[model samples]
Target: MPLMRIQLDSDRQTARRVVELHRTGKVHRESRDAARAEVWRRGRTPAGETVFVGTTNGEPVRLIYDVEVYRDVTA
Candidate 1:
C-alpha cells in the first residue's frame, strides 16, 4: 500500500495533541509510527514541516494536527 503523507504543524502543541489523541484511541500507534518513519527517512523538507505518513486499507487519509475526538451523535 502506498503511504499517505500526513503533515502536522511544527510545534510542541501539535505533537502533544497527537499523543493525546492516541491515548484516547482516536489514533493508532501504527498510523503515527508510519508517518514518523517516513518523515525520518526523507529528512526534513525545505518547508520545515513535520509530516506523518499513514495508510489504511490502501486508502490515503490526512490527519490534522489539532484533532478533536468527537463522539457519534446518532448511533
Candidate 2:
C-alpha cells in the first residue's frame, strides 16, 4: 500500500523490538505487516504514540498511535 513517506528515525528502537518479537514468536509476520501499514497510514500507534518505519516511498514516517503489547507487565 502507498504510504505518506515520513522520517521514522525515532522508531528504529521500536522496529528492532518488533523484529525481536517476531523472531521469538511473540508476534506474527502478518501482524508486523499490518502494524507497519498502520504506521504508514496513521503515522502513529493506536494510542497516539509516535512510531517510525521504512516507508513504501523509501522514506520514514512518524506513527500517530501506540502499539498494543500483550506481554505480561506485572513482572
Encode model 2's per-residue lDDT on 1-75: one tens digit a residue: 123333333254565565566456565354345555655475443333223332222235232223542233355
Candidate 2: deviation at residue 64, Å?
Answer: 16
TM-score of 2: 0.29
Instruction: Compute the lDDT of residue 52 as modeled in candidate 2.
Output: 32
Estimate TM-scores for all models: 0.29, 0.29
Model 1's TM-score against the true structure: 0.29
Instruction: Name the 10 consecutive residues with the lowest summed lDDT in model 2.
Output: 49-58
Tens-place lDDT digits, model 1, residues 1-75: 123355533345445565677566576455455555555565532233233332222223234421222233456
Q: What is the lDDT of residue 63 in candidate 2?
A: 26
